[model samples]
Target: MTTTDVHVFFLLLCLFSPKVAAHGRIPTTLDGPFSPRTRRFDPSLRLGSDDVPMDDPKLAKKVGFNFPEQIALAISFSHTSMWVSWVTGDAQIGKNVMPLDPSTVGSEVWYGEESGKYSFVQNGTAMVYNQLYPFEGLLNYTSGIIHHVRLDGLKPGTRYYYKCGDSSLKAMSKEHTFETFPTSPDHFLRKIAVVGDLGLTLNSTSTIDHLSKNDPSLILMVGDLSYANQYLTTGGKGVPCYGCAFPDAPIRETYQPRWDGWGRFMEPLTSKIPMMVIEGNHEIEPQARGINFSSYLTRFAVPSLESHSESNFYYSFNAGGIHFIMLGAYIDYNQTGAQYAWLKKDLLKVDRELPPGLWQLGILLGDGGNIEQIDIEHADDPGKCPSKNPSIPEFGGICHLNFSSGPAKGKFCWDQQPEWSAFRESSFGHGILEVINSTYALWTWHRNQDAYKESSKGDQIYIVRQPEICLANIAKVSSKDQ
Candidate 1:
């Protein structure tokens, strides 16, 4: 799709805990549906920035041959278990590339409650993926061995030190530590960092730096991890608009190494904090023979099997008392699809008493300072609505339609800001979710520009849950798993 044909916008809906008190009385959702608020795009800052070079110290490989790099953590279906993933060896990209054999190296993790005291051992699986473009001039790419190990039979709300690598080769990594989420929902869930469309750019560094300062316990990455598709296989300079640069290319070209760079760049934070990710459009790196999402599928390990999910694109897990259901926007979400069936089954199993209440709310997050130009125009804005036939999706049908009911009934665009949009801005930033109690959660947004001011927040709100009013509806859905 051409640049003009695709206008991308990142949407994030997350719950967070309150770190600092608001300037004044914090508005809660119980205050009724508030009026729409809009923050006009800032003109001082450029709409976009260049991606961070692969040679940058943060992205460059720091590990030795056959050593673990890009180490990261992910949560399993329960608090008693967690997933550890890392990459070994070097990725190759050229006209003729050779793929690495995962079996050559072992996947193991050594962990214990105290530092330097080995108590438990776990062995997991390893894998590799290739991005090949057989067409002339396009280079092929093969990845390093990716390993994932799940550690089970662990206590909750406790700290554990660990190291990952192949012990046989004497290539064990340095020590790392992470605390498990509290088993009870009544316990306060610390900071949960939520970001979307986070590309590797100067702005991304700022975003991540500010996020790390908050010391979040868990991270919810709302897709669009790396904008690799904006680059060609040769990987010189990346473009903001893919179609504008190489319009005649046989297929969409991507620098697969960008994935490795992103993993290394994020290793500092992801190595200690569990990051749960759902696939975004950029991850669909299509290659020869109709292959797609090869890098995304093989690199990071999600709790798909533990959650009974058939695909890695979507899954669900619990952090404290909160059950997070991560949905895949690019996948089939129709009521007749497998995803819908899974959603139905999962929702039916929700025990309100475990978390006190299941209040349905939505929060959309974007503007995470990616290389792509910031999305300023809204569908409701004048001359911005989708045409009769919008750009067709890679896998789905033309589903865009005019509002059947609402202020813009029968029209594709609304003259004013839609009522559903509580607030909108074009600045690059990240959000933090804090669950204060069973009935309340504080949501705060931090702009990258105001990184120095810890007290400053772009937006803040309290999400109050009213079980008395919503419990009746929840009782209707009986648990099928029971």
Candidate 2:
């Protein structure tokens, strides 16, 4: 869609640890519903930035056919097991592109706690995929061998050095290291950064660099990973508005090579820290015969079957005592859908649920008359509260409902700001959630423009949970497998 047709916003929500680092006390959620507070958008921080070129050094391929690149990690249900993925061989793009034989390359990983020492070895599967555009004049693309290996029976909160590639070809990747999440339920993972709508651009580089400086143990990517779909079937310079740029093209054309470039661009950070990702609309690269999600599905691995969700679109995983449910926004989230059904069961089984990035953080509220305008309206703003047909649904159900017991009971709109809205802002920013314990979590919102200007926060507060009040609602289920 054109830029005007598609007004998307990024919401960077970071889930952090309380004991990690803090300098002040904060308020809790028990202080009653907060009044609506708004921070106007800062004119200084440009909402848009230039995309990095495909040939940029960071996105350039650094390895040959036999060697592995894009080394990354994912949690396999628990810390006891992990999944490692990488790519080999050169991706081909042209009118006629042949797919690579994944079996030709052996997928293997060697790891140990100590450097230069070997204590464990694992062999995994590999495969290649293609994104074909059969329409005349459009280009077709084929991917390199993508590999995923699962390493199980490991200790948590421990560091492990490893290498992945075709061991037989002597083209294994150089040794890289990653640490497991904290093992104890009481212990928590510190410094998690969240981001979204991360196209391979100068802005994306800045965001990544900023996140790296924060030294996050894990990353929660909210979606719209790489905007490769923004380009045309015949690769050329990208435009900010896709629909306007290629008004005549058949379906949205994506430069598949951009995916490879993005993989390389993110390798450094991903290879070191475990990143959990859910799909965004951009991942749905529709191709021949209604096929889709080829790149997203084949490139990364998530704990779907492990979490018993059985679908990569949505799943739940635990990090110590905190359980994270990565929901695919592109998926059907209605009450009747399978995703909703799975979510119902998952939430019921939460032994302990503590709630929680910055990246992919897009606009939270855009101008009215579109899906992006669906926002948490301030009840006090006179004439601003929509009456009839107030809400609109995008890829999901219409969930607008009246509060049955709150101050706005029996009314679709409140006369004033809602107590639950402690604060709001129209600026581009990222938020960090620090869970102190089962009772309190600190949340701080950082504006993009003020990132380096003395650590000024646009919004900061503590979310205190009331166990006594909601204890009866807490459900218990078997955690034998989790």
Candidate 3:
């Protein structure tokens, strides 16, 4: 065949390939800046699950006073150190409630490499917080003394057994074990699980069960944990969405017991695996005197100080070769704000050969099978595009603005699918990130319905980094030099 004819045939074959558009084929960022696409919520699958009852055995406070009930672990500054936190004493909820003295309980943890044999005992700090609604008829809630003890000088990749509580009061927990991340050249931070908007629902339980079965070394709860704000101050059934009932109330009411229940429900997993968290909108349970984020700030732990971000709202942590920047959407994300400054410094420190998302060159994983069900709104849908100023930021100033340059220039919602968003699906799913090497990482999305179906994945992609290209670009001179 002639040279021209041969070239024409080759181009045609490439364009008509069947496998290229198939769902089974995994994609890479190298093939994009892709056109935006949105997948509508499935009609067959459930939109959401009912909140788990307080009477459920898993969420009940099983431990007695002075004993640790909601035991949890968090990664500190480095692999050599880890934080263990738990609660002691029974909480009180009534018209005239008194908070327990934190000093009443001696915070301590006994741990070692061997099971049932503790070689080290560490002392920690203890404190308590209260959620009070000044208005009448709204019962006040006080939390049990929360203890946080740090275990330094730990061996990397070694499994250590621990029990935390007030030993002086003869209250100590049963033995539990966890392994530290690998310290050296192996770069083995195995499956990192990511979940968002996880409320205390049967579907949330299913998500947790499936995630546990996957055996992830770490978990990142992006936000909206427990859904405690969905309840009334009286501990009665609340409206599904936030602030739907009693819109003009003085302050948003929350049943603080839901936090306790959530802590208990998560203890089984958090006790073994370090679950790092960032605050979400639901965590902003506004009370009198402008006190918000009380439960979220008090209950869980993050590598804020350790990572040098210092603020719990936004921070960075390294797991093997991957560096994660957990940004707080509820807080100040403005360019002039503290979070933005910290983020800029962090980006400068990151190997530029890395991916985007600040210019937001990152994946948006919102498919965590949540109780509120799957998201259905799409910017490109006929009437689904959201309006400007739809909602105010929970903690910081509302900074969402119109596009300066794009098809939707001067508009908040795009008229059509924007090119940046490669694809989106409204479903309940959790993502597992498997870092294979310094340059390649595989991300898989597991749907709620696909549990127990091995090799079944809703979305799979390989994130490839171009270090050489980034290095060359960094070394290149600016246009001013020309």
**Which stretches of candidate 1 lie above 4 Å from their native place?**
1-24, 352-356, 383-392, 468-482
Give candidate 3 misplaced runs (Cα > 4 Å).
Answer: 1-25, 33-35, 344-361, 387-402, 468-482
Colliding pairs, model 1: 11-365, 12-363, 12-364, 12-365, 13-363, 15-433, 16-433, 16-434, 17-433, 17-434
Tell me the tens digit of each residue's lDDT in model 3 across 359-434.
1224465455445565566655688666665445345566678889879889877777666667766666677876
CA RMSD per model (angstroms): 4.0, 6.5, 9.1
Worst window of 10 by summed lDDT in candidate 3: 4-13
Q: What overall lDDT, based on C-alpha atoms, would model 2 receive against the true structure?
A: 0.69
lDDT of each: 0.80, 0.69, 0.73
Q: Per-residue lDDT of 1-482 in model 1, one digit per residue for the tens?
A: 00111212222212233334444688888886878877776677653667899999999999898899999999998889999999999999998988899999999999999999979999999999999999999999999999999999989999999999999999999999999988653465678888887889888888899999999988988877888888899995887767767778889889989989999999999999999888877788889999998988998889999989998888888777567887887778876799878877776566522434564644466556677757767766667775776433444467667779988898767878878777777777788887776567788988876645767888888887776777665565434323
Per-candidate TM-score against the hidden true structure:
0.91, 0.81, 0.86
Candidate 2, superposed: residue stretches over 4 Å from native: 1-22, 352-421, 426-429, 451-454, 468-482
- Candidate 1 Cα deviation (angstroms), residue 205: 0.7
Q: What lDDT does candidate 3 reach at residue 135? A: 86
Residue 383's lDDT in candidate 3: 83
lDDT of 1: 0.80
